[model samples]
Target: MKTDDAVSALGALANEHRLAVFRLLVQAGPEGRAAGVIAEKLDLPASSLSFHLAHLTRAGLILQRRESRSLIYSADFVAMNDLVGFLTENCCGGASCAPAAQAASKKRRAS
Candidate 1:
């Protein structure tokens, strides 16, 4: 994930409803949730859910498929991992000073 791609993904998630939908889909896992279920769970209208889903889809944060007449949505974990990688790639200035490295150090100490 390049900086531009990461920025776009982050920008798409900046909305309240979009963030809620993303979180819900992440919890739903690979099986995903139906559009109706998402709407009900979030107390949103179908149209509103559709709008958020479209945003997430365009951001490559989620995938949608047609299961019979229903639309199923799931998080795109690969894309998510890439985004995280991009954000942390330069952590600690290529040294071991980053928080992530520090967390790993603590784990080793605890052991």
Candidate 2:
């Protein structure tokens, strides 16, 4: 990810509800969860959830799809890993840090 993209992603996650929502989707796996379910799980109002979801979506940290009558939201794991990479790419100022994000990204791809 570029530095600008990283800043956007981080900004989206900086919120309390947005962070919780993103973490919930990550735990939900690639299949993700519906908007209502996210609201229920995070105890957020529908309006607030909509706003936060839009913010995350615009930041490219999440993906949204129409699953029939429901709108499914899932974390953009690749984008997530890229953000992690951007943050830790200079870890220890070494040529390679082999951060957890890389490992997790590989594992996720394997599945």
Candidate 3:
């Protein structure tokens, strides 16, 4: 992913509600969830959910599809993986990052 793309993706996820929506879609897997399901689970109004979904779509972080009359939303896993790869490129200067990941995990539990 280009730097600009990464920036856009990160910007989209910067909001609390957007982050929650994205995570929910990711958890939903490739099958995704309908727009109504998302709004209900997130306790967000339709207008608000539409706005966030549009934002994530523009950022290429999520995908939308029509299933009958329902609009389903799912995470763009390829884009997500690309963003992760871009961020972690040359990570630890080519050294293993497992140690760092482990440390971070431990820190999270300690807090």
Candidate 4:
């Protein structure tokens, strides 16, 4: 991804509500969730959730679709992967940093 695109994605995720919404959508996978369901699960007002969803959608981090009467939202996994790849492309001087990062992540989870 380009630098500006990465920055935009990061900026979108910088907010608490937006980050929560994005993470929830990621966990929900490609099938996604309805707007009402997301609002209920996140305990957010419909208006507030709509604002965050719009921000994410504008950032190209998430996608929205109409399913009958409900609006469904899902993470854009390609954009997500591209952002991650961009961030980690030169990590630790490009010496296969993932193994160490994964080991540290596992250790932290085990704690």
* Alpha-carbon RMSD of each model: 4.4, 7.1, 1.2, 1.9
Question: What TM-score do all the candidates reach, one by one?
Answer: 0.84, 0.84, 0.94, 0.89
TM-score of 1: 0.84
- Tens digits of per-residue lDDT, candidate 2, 39-110, equal 998899999999999999999999999989999999999999999889877786776646766988999999
Give the alpha-carbon lDDT of every model. 0.91, 0.93, 0.98, 0.96
lDDT-based ranking: 3, 4, 2, 1
Q: What is the lDDT of residue 29 in candidate 3?
A: 100
| Top candidate by lDDT | 3
Top candidate, metric TM-score: 3
lDDT of 3 at 111: 100
Q: In candidate 1, residue 111 scores what lDDT?
A: 100
Q: What is the lDDT of residue 101 in candidate 1?
A: 75
Q: Model 4 has how many clashing residue pairs?
A: 0
Tens-place lDDT per residue, model 1, 1-111, is 788889989998999999999999889999999999999999999888888899999999999999999989999999989998998888767886667777999999999
Could you tally the backbone clashes for each prediction?
0, 0, 0, 0
The whole-model C-alpha lDDT of candidate 1 against the native structure comes to 0.91
